[model samples]
Target: MLDLLEADRAFVAENEAQILDLEAQITARQRWIDLLRDAQRAAKQRLSSYKYPVLTLPNEILGEIFMHFLPPYPDPPPLVGNLSPICLTHVCRRWRDVACKTPSLWRAIELHPSVHRLSNLGETLSLIAKWSARSGHSPLSIRMECRRQFDPISIFTSLIPHRARWEHLNLNFGSGSYIQTLDIDRPMPLLRSLTLTVWDAVGTPLPLLEVPLLRTVVINDQGSPSLVLPWSQLTSLTLRRTHPGACLSILREASQLLECRLHLWSQRTPLGGGAVVLPRLESLVFERDSEVCREFFESLVTPALRRLELPEAFLRPHDVETLKAYISKSGCTLQSLRVTALASLIQQILYRMAFRSIPTITFCE
Candidate 1:
């Protein structure tokens, strides 16, 4: 009888422990349910409060807002207009209509031969044609960058019909031979800015580009023959990793240049050797190479110069002193000066300027 009673007690103890465990699990599950319910309610309320209102603005206003997001240049990256379709259109029906109608959003047409294969070239050209048609009479910007595998001559010729309507043109040839027989005789009268990157051999008697209102020109060359700029109304010129021969060609072409950025490589010779004078130059930036700075100062005869930037690595004590003395002697109309040099060179410049309180000089370390 005692054994039976002990066995019953043991069974009851086991049952009690299991009951307690089950109760604890039930409590935990109930707490989780309550928390989830509260979270769901809070999320719904937040969603109700923060949801985008149905836009009642006119189509014109909505179109203008969408246009603001469109890049000023047509040949922006392929992803430029993707956001409008993904996010802008999904906002509301009104936004969707506005986004679809705003032709400027689709106006920028980029032909990247690297991203598209030869089999896909037809499709790419078709897409460009569709976008150009959608742009209507509005001036379009065309960016054509091709890899060595793709024929740039064929691609350029295909887009020749729309050349007259182009306001901005950016041609980047990576690894392909330079365009030898390009006929840009028909004037791009509205072209305002041009950026060309050449990588292969460019032969003699360069292409003649007639961009009447051209303002900005950027030339980046890896191994191409020197480019010749024939623009007259150029206000800004940027040369990056180019040969001295190319640099001279640019300076010779852009007679009315106002802003100049020269990024020289160590291997190439210095530019600005002859009587190349920038009559209306306001800002000059010399990056990476100090030899260019020495050569620039030697050849510079700018009367309307206002700002000058020197490379930090090349800003030696003697160079800074020479610059200061030159500024004082030349009666330079400099208002803002930025010297990217060492602290010691800055200290030397400040020490020299102790006598005369001229324009404020900014040191960028």
Candidate 2:
């Protein structure tokens, strides 16, 4: 029995020695495997450097290139797809880091119902939230075009939180009801330009009183009476499809206007007030489907006016006399005059001959 036990013990010792030797081999092989991995990684990186030279450019240059990749400032790029800045993040880790770090690339946002599907509203809103966050604290240029079916408030809600940074805001809604819900009454110190267009009449007034930097304004049709702006600060103004009465009302406060364009639609309302003298007015354009009222042209007093454009009918009863009297009344040196004539060639020739003293005179039939 003792001899048998000794044989078994010898067998156990041999098995234990073989297992230790195999374990030692594994440890040494693992070290070799680790070294090979490091070598593979370094070789791959060197090969990648030669294959993709653009990756070798400094991040600053790359970031600058990204800036040009977008549309000019105040003009926003697409929200998604290849043309969008968001696509830059999908290329690789390096690019994602660079794009997210560049705040200007994400400063402007466009939420158009035509550009995005209604089903993706949630997704688009999420993307906008992320986009705005990436913009840091940069002043934002936001353009939102909403149709009747699409609730602008969903997208606008995301924007209201960032209103303080709003530099340029353009809101075009098919329904005026959307405008009433857009609680943009808060102070926006950086706001400079505003363009508002609404198809339906707005009952509520959209007050933008805190915009100290606002200089440009464009209101379309029914939106004219709905906005309460600091008109005295405006340098450029465009009113489309607005009545002459409304235009006169707005002009009363816009004493500093340098350029003005009015597309008159209705003249039923009387021009009850006296003349509005725009001391700094330089360019004036009046457009109407029909002839404008004589009083409409005569109501404006622009001493500094250099360029005047209007329909020949506005000077009815006596064209030459009215033109001469208007020039004398304004005391403005006319550099250029443009008239849309519907009268006979003889009448046009009369204007050309009578206004020979003017530098340039153009007639459009």
Estimate, for each residue in 300-362, the C-alpha lDDT of model 1 and write its tens digit. 566677887776544344665666665664456887666664466747466347524447567
Stretch of 10 with least lDDT, candidate 2: 113-122
Best by TM-score: 2
lDDT (Cα atoms) of all candidates against the true structure:
0.66, 0.86
The best candidate by lDDT is 2
Candidate 1: residue 254 Cα off by (Å): 2.9
Candidate 2 lDDT over residue span 2-49, tens digit each: 999999999999999999999999999999999999999999988876
Clashes of each: 3, 0
Can you give the TM-score per candidate against the true fold?
Answer: 0.71, 0.79
